[model samples]
Target: MTTKSLSIPLDFPFPSPKAHPLLTLHSKIQFPCKFPLFSLPQRIQFLRNQCPPKCQNPNDNNNPVPYTSQQEAHFTETQEAISQFLQEFGISAAESNSIALNSPKYAKMLFDSVKDLEEWTSWKSGGDGNEFATLGFKEKVAYMAKEKGDNGKVAFLESLGLSLSSSMNVARYLHGESLPNLIHKVKYMKEILFSDSDDKRLVGKYARCMMMNLSIPIDEDLQQTLSLFEKVEARRGGLDMLGSSEVTFRCLVESFPRILLLPLDLHLKPMVEFLDSVGVPKEHMREIFLLFPPVIICDITGINRKVQALKKVWAFDKDFGKMLLKYPWILSTAIQKNYKEIVSFFHMEKVDKSSVDTAIRSWPHILGCSTSKLEVMVEQLAKLGIRNKKLGQVISKSPQLLLRKPQEFLQVVLFLEDLGFDRETVGQVASRCPEIFAASIEKTLKKKIEFLDRIGVSKDHLPRVIKKYPELLVSDVNRTILPRMKYLKDVGLSKKDIAFMVRRFSPLLGYSIEEVLRPKYEFLVNTMKKPVEDVVGYPRYFSYSLEKKIMPRFWVLKGRNIECSLKDMLAKNDEEFAADFMGF
Candidate 1:
């Protein structure tokens, strides 16, 4: 089919609702360009204002959509604007008011898109008596999505399993973005994300998130991003896709506003290849994009330089790849600069570059954190003997501490001190399990403490127990701690038995039930002929390596016909046991 070129008259009037009637020349302003050049907000505002003062074809039975004040700026104006436009379109006052009140935001979009279609159709058809007047709102937008002025978009929308009104709603979004970009974006999405799926609505959902991102320019802004989205083939050679699910794809698009606007070959494809080369699995691509949106827009060469810098100084083994996956922004130029600044700060503090490098790799998100924030956290740590080389060591072991606000880290320190941990002991806990500083004051740390206390761990014992195993605070009380407590109860240890054992050895509760506790308890009851009560007295019974220590010692005792308490059998050093128990 031959393409019909749009022929707008030289005197074509562009709508300008914001202009006052006395300064009416602006309303009649001619557009030498094809599509209108105004921004989305202006377009919506213009539509709001375009509601005629008196509709030429008004239906009088119902009141027009009410104009009411809202906390949102210009919300009343938006409602007033929409009421008149809907009335001008011959909608009843009741319907107009319902639409205007329900969600004036979408009403604005619908009005803007429908009006754009009306104006463009008049231009294309040379003032014909509104060929679009007989059509519904969705049909008008589907017509706007024409490929070469044909039935391209109308057919595509029909295939999406949406209602006629819903199709029109999607078309409103599609209409806002230029047709060509919409095509390329949908095509790109289909190739990358939904190639294997037959569900057409999946494509529609992703297109809505990606095609008309508020951050990207549509017709008014420069339109010269290379059309790399076109002719892009699907992944080959069983490539790991960034992700396959609709949720991940939607999140990735929402995370990065300009993702659909980017050209495929020049931006995304190369970045995908780079990530794959660096050992980032395709399944993790969504995470990389979501965490560092600029990664796709950034020059791949710069990213390569950052990766090379990391490998040259440190390394990009599986762990470094894992670091990049965790904090993909580490490849951002700004983050790289921040990384350098942090290294320099640490150097001036007499912390070696290697230590800082280790710290960054261990917690790469620190690269994205502001240097001022890091310094603030540093000062906080200084109060706890965590400065200079010791600071670097603490950071290397638990670099996520840098992400904590100084106030938050101090809150954890204060809480620990209130629990009777001395400042020195608190410092030790900070070094041992720094993430406790980052856990929620209410959700995680407090919840675990309360769970322990409710289960009969005494106030006097909390300090020693928590200080010995600060990680217990970080473990999930329901998933990790409670289940283990339940397992002990099931194995003939009472809740009190478990609580007393935990007071002596808090880390005892953290062990895997199936891996450590289950086998030891079973053997203690079934094979060792020791009562399950034996473990309640010496919960360190779980900590010993079954094959390496416990079994070897127990078999020696069994052979020697020795009978002893759990403490006497397990707590003695092997040399002491052999000397004392075996008579060596």
Candidate 2:
């Protein structure tokens, strides 16, 4: 579609009516005219003297004043000015007062006749048919007829075929009517002045006049008033007017708070169109727009209908629609504030894991702000035995939840770890749960073995140590065996042998062998190397036989000079050799 640009001047002035002749005369005449019964010629002369230079038509003086055209033009201008003034205040004339008055036919005729006479005099006098019309003789007649009673007022209004409410006078007296009422009054006056006149030009004049007169007390009312202009444009089929209305709406909505709450639909198509034309922020409008629900469902059964309607209206923006699905609170301020209650009211189905995950993923920061809530949620997952890493990732990513109460978080993490969690998982959980590392585990079998290695216990000996010291498994090997191992080399066994024996026998003996061996190394060494002959108590027999066998070798060796051979080894093997070797 081709777009038409409307350039509404920022300072368009309302058209003002020409001054009334009677008012001019009254201003000039200091004292009331006592000569009320003047001749027709005298009255003419009197009017001519008071009239402005433009109204002195010498050629037309003899004829009755052709005041119709002049009065119509003057009234039109004055009405235009009034409408413009009202529009400036953000008031609309149309929606405010659309009803015509109720009265008898004769009364309507009399009223119309009186109105025609007023118009004629206004033109002849070259005066503006405006608030100053009260000075005209025709106006006096209309006022007299109006005061005749309710019947008279109804008749006058009916002649104009306009709706007139009795409450209007009361409303004026009260001064309590809202902006909408003032707009209606201006609109009614404009309609009367420009009824069915094919001059499309006057519409702008009237629109501008209405725009000028408009005023709203609150931002919200101002928005509604501006929106009404858009409606006027749509009805009048004027794109320029619509564009102007849209520009005004944009300015008002931007400046005012809660103005976007005005309903915009088929009834307000022009407003919606204007908003679109001006590129108003859609997201910002979502909450305000939804505030006016076309149909409210009071029961669950009506949900389908509500959803369908909402979908149709919001279908263009999926994100907005989705927001509504999850957060209907966006529809109203009251609802948004009490959103939790609303959620509970609907007995909303439990959010699925995927939904919860999406929410957490979407706003990870919220988890920290709502740690207790999140923890409860996570606990539910735990109860479900969902050991998925994604849960851990969620917790880890939301560091706030972990850091909120470090001690509590750590405790939870440790508890999870104790349930057989792997280190990587535990560490990640711990990062999110800071309380676990607060205290160190006391030394025990497992801790001791770990401590032994920590103190430089060789890896090869670790298993052996564990095996021999079954009882030491419960002892603090780090404090006991570690201190005693240094004493092994001082006792006769080599450090390497001591280390090997401790590793091998520690577990079997169920106590740290290093602890047991440090005090008994000498006795242990003696026991380990004892000969088979000594153990069997046959040392004397073996010694005699060995001497008989080696005596010849010794004699042979002495003569051959092969000294320190078989004879020397046999000499060492004897009891005297053992006694000397031991230094006994």
Across residues 175-235, which tens digit of lDDT does each residue of candidate 2 receive?
Answer: 3333443334334323322233344343344344334422212234334434544544554
Give candidate 2's whole-model lDDT: 0.35
Model 2 earns a TM-score of 0.19
What TM-score, to 2 decimals, does candidate 1 have? 0.60
Q: Model 2, poorest ten-residue lDDT window?
A: 95-104
- Indicate the residue-level lDDT of 218 in model 2: 24
lDDT for model 1 comes to 0.59
- Cα lDDT tens digits, model 1, 444-512, are 888877888898887799988988898988987778887888888887888778888889899998899
Q: What are the per-model C-alpha RMSD values against the true structure? A: 13.1, 31.9
Clashing pairs in 1: 48-81, 51-85, 65-97
